[model samples]
Target: MRQLLQDLFDKRVNQFVSDKRSKKLFFPKAETKQACLANRSAEIVKVKAAGKIIEESVEDEFQTIKYQAHYQYLIKQNGILYMEEEMEDRLAKFYKNALVMDEEIRPILESENDPETELNHLDLEDHTERLSYAYDRLKAVQYAERWWNSYNPAYKKFQNDCTNFISQCLKAGGAPMRGYPKRDAGWWLQSNNWSYSWAVAHSLRLYLSNSKIGLRAKEVSSPDLLKLGDVICYDFEGDGRFNHNTLVTGKDANGMPLVNAHTYNSRMRYWAYEDSSAYTPNIKYKFYSIIDE
Candidate 1:
């Protein structure tokens, strides 16, 4: 398993530094990564990967294994270099200790954005007492970078964790939580209980749109207008049901947002997500500037 992963990362590093790509290897992801880097005039100076087996089973001479591969990249742009990390979940099959098939397990998200089918109500108990909140962008971005590739022990880790992770970033920025005990109401997470807005991509989008009190946001016209700690919701299929969310952690040399997200566990990635496996021609995005007063 270690050698297999080593070979995989070796191919990835070669592809990043070489102009000629091997068709035998799965190069779509590599192509995307390179394109995103090129757009910033950046190149990967070094790459390293390590794998950890999550599960394994052996039947006769055939084996199936689930593992996670962590990739660290040293990227150089302009005159500076920095590190970025990503984690991918993979399933591999081996026959008599020879690797056969290795495939990435993409995230499968649920649809919770349709107003005709899903709940779109915000049950705020207090309408007159508006809380004074100040959003700390630095703290939010720091939290995002700190936990981009890992899960916090204090929160319940969900299979679809994009929104839950973004909610945590917002909370770290001092966003007050309200509307507890109701699943369809304000943005909040209390112990094992949480509002849909606190964890669902679509629900959080709606909450940010309708929220006028604590922890609210303003819908921005463009991604460039968003500052650090802002949120970007993704409707991968452009079908109105949001499936993913990310936090703005940094900006490229061109000033485009470099986001961090869970689920795929990416850091310092381009906000457009055009190279994403789930990306489609009809993808849609909603940019929200976090409101702090």
Candidate 2:
């Protein structure tokens, strides 16, 4: 009887676990679904005395306001700074009466009468390379498809795994790692340790834009213009502050790019993530092409 039960369990495991398993996830339990939709708030040291409203726009059913705060904030792990983003906040005021949606009351934030704080310049080196990107699109796409469900053992898993997974895909495409023992800059992965760009979506965006070599990008207008290995930055709240990233892995019969990302653990998913919990009526997106020469 024990042998019979063991045989049944082994058969189930074999049927469930595979390198080509479906990336389309479906969690029936409420608790299981909540785990995939959690968003990490900023780790700010000193919040702004008064946030300056930099930009504001109203979409079909929601209003988005981009505010820059005066503060010092950094995401540091083990006393080393990984990434320091601009202290900013985006407010998405939803008009509940506009559409038939769930009940959500996003509190509006108010700024004080103080002026915007000054920022100091840090002496950072700038490295420029005239070389072209040699990252193989086929390899990155393959790696993404293979490991989208089951993670590779070589990399470190984080609470937010989307950017980290993308970094692995980029490395599989022959993007060399840089920076060791320090987490302030460079997209490096050594001894299972990785830089901020390898894990943080916002930091990866900055690194790709500012990189001199290895990886670089140019912003495009829409996802339809993106190539096989391009990236799409998701501003689920329609704010300028992007919070999620996905890689283009496949295209459908209509030629729309199907993307893959982690955290929610999706593979070859739809590019327009209207199903995301953070998605708002005023959601915005930025498309970038990872330039290869």
For candidate 2, the TM-score is: 0.57
Q: How do the predictions measure up, each by TM-score?
A: 0.90, 0.57
lDDT of 1 by residue, 1-293 (tens): 56665676576667765663545435456677777787779888887778898988889988888889888888888877777778888888888777788788887776332233565555645477898888999999999988998899999888788999999999999999988787777778887788888888888988888888898889999989999999999999999978899999988766778899998699987799886788999999999998888
Residue 176: error of model 1 in Å? 0.8
Q: Which stretches of candidate 1 lie over 4 Å from their true place?
A: 20-26, 111-117, 120-126
lDDT of 2 by residue, 57-86 (tens): 667766454443322222222333322112
| Residue 169 lDDT, candidate 2, scale 0-100 | 87
User: What is the Cα-based lDDT of residue 269 in candidate 2?
Assistant: 54
lDDT of 1: 0.83
Alpha-carbon lDDT, every model = 0.83, 0.56
